[model samples]
Target: MLRGLTTVSHFSDDVPAAVAWYAELLGIEPYFQREVQGKLAYVEFRLGDYQHELGILDRRFAPPGAGTPGGTMTYWAVDDVEATYQRLLDLGGTAQQSPTEHGPGFVTASVIDPFGNQLGVMFNQHYLDVFTGRPA
Candidate 1:
């Protein structure tokens, strides 16, 4: 059995600026900002009911051999993938993939944030039905 997601983390050169942009994108301000280990680092913000943390650290602090804009990507499921994708575009996000059907009643799209972080918008009526114990 899988537990619910706890948090998603992203690395940024400028923590404050990243937080602000994300806040605007998500329409929520950070709930916590604090320094860690003698350096200005880490901010956590809520998205819907989930928590996302962004870390600000020196280049050397990056994971071993992790290049800038590491290939890691995060997808956030939304009720309306197309609308969310367009809203992100209007908010200055770079579109990576226009909305398209992925499977039976499933649609998805993606965009790159100002900081080069890829954000995906997804919708799956089947998955929703399964999770809610309803017929698809």
Candidate 2:
């Protein structure tokens, strides 16, 4: 059985710094964290509809030779593509793709966070309408 996305996780060498950076970007603190013996192990932020989660894991868990801006990419919804794109860049996230409108109101952009993971942002009309009962 396959379930849809419940969480999206990113890796970072520094948990606290990654937490701070993501908190600033998302404008909210993580709602849950995994810690063992009082040491940070993981942090998760719930955002968007379905409480879709974005998690930050300590990079120690990554396989050897892993690097930032990895192969996988996941796009989160954003209301304003241009402003959000600029904001991520301003926050030290390197640009991977500038915002581009695909077709019929679907737009997207991507960036590599300071920690080297790809972060995607999209203004997806269909997804927004289905979730919110209003067109994007």
Candidate 3:
């Protein structure tokens, strides 16, 4: 059976630049990196309460049909969707979706990073409840 997410990977034509961009956005440098054929091939950062892995891979190793920047979007939990969306924009991410409310307790936003990956942020009551051990 499928389990929780362990790593989220994004591809970039320039791995070093992507790593630098993400480092600035996250306010931390990658904890690990790998090189292939004397060229930087990948870098990874551990983040979030559970230390989820965010990886940037050199596009040269991507699969044949994986040239496109995005497909399915994965939303990360945030305390404030609007603030996070604004921060992403300030970090040079292009706006894809402005903060929008869904139902009573869910707000979501998305952006396209300079590397062309879709990064989503959400303020969800359920996530906050679980994270804070509070009843919803």
Candidate 4:
């Protein structure tokens, strides 16, 4: 019933700023966007070797009863967890968790973006193995 990771999304109150911030972080502009009367409402970016989708939707578009921006987090793969974590902070994200190794080579970190969404990052051997077709 499950295929694979398809998309990871976040909410933003300011579309242009969020788009600019992620464009800098990912080094690519969003490939898809929806606008209402010339105002961006939603945007998507394809990233990584897997071409995983990252969506940023306006917070107003969220379902009813969704109060704040904390929920299931999807950790993105990065070459350097520590450096990426710091870079997120340097780009105005606040720290949620410092990078830490979790035995047997798994390392993860978390940060709250300027838009109040939680963004996670990791340096994973399994991801590299799967991406490169190498044994983990």
lDDT for model 1, please: 0.70
Model 3 lDDT per residue over 113-135, tens place: 99888899998899777777944
Clashing pairs in 3: none
Alpha carbon lDDT of each predicted model: 0.70, 0.88, 0.89, 0.88
How far residue 127's Cα lies from its native spot in candidate 4, in Å, is 1.0
Per-residue lDDT tens digits for candidate 4, residues 1-136, read: 9999997778788988999999998899999999987889999999998799999888888776442556677899999999999999999999999999997768999998898888999999998878788444
Give the lDDT of residue 63 in candidate 4: 72
- TM per model? 0.75, 0.89, 0.91, 0.91
Write one digit per residue (lDDT tens) for candidate 2, span 1-136: 8779987888898889999999999899999989866779799999987789999988887767665665677889889999999999999999999999999779999999999889999999988778878555
In order of listing, the candidates' clash counts read: 0, 2, 0, 0
Runs with alpha carbons beyond 4 Å of true place in candidate 1? 1-4, 36-40, 49-61, 65-72, 130-136
Task: List where candidate 3 sits over 4 angstroms from the true fold.
Answer: 67-70, 134-136
Error of 1 at 120 (Å): 0.9
Q: Estimate candidate 1's RMSD in Å.
A: 3.9
Question: Which tens-of-lDDT digit does each residue in 98-134 have in candidate 1?
Answer: 9999778788888877666667778878656766884
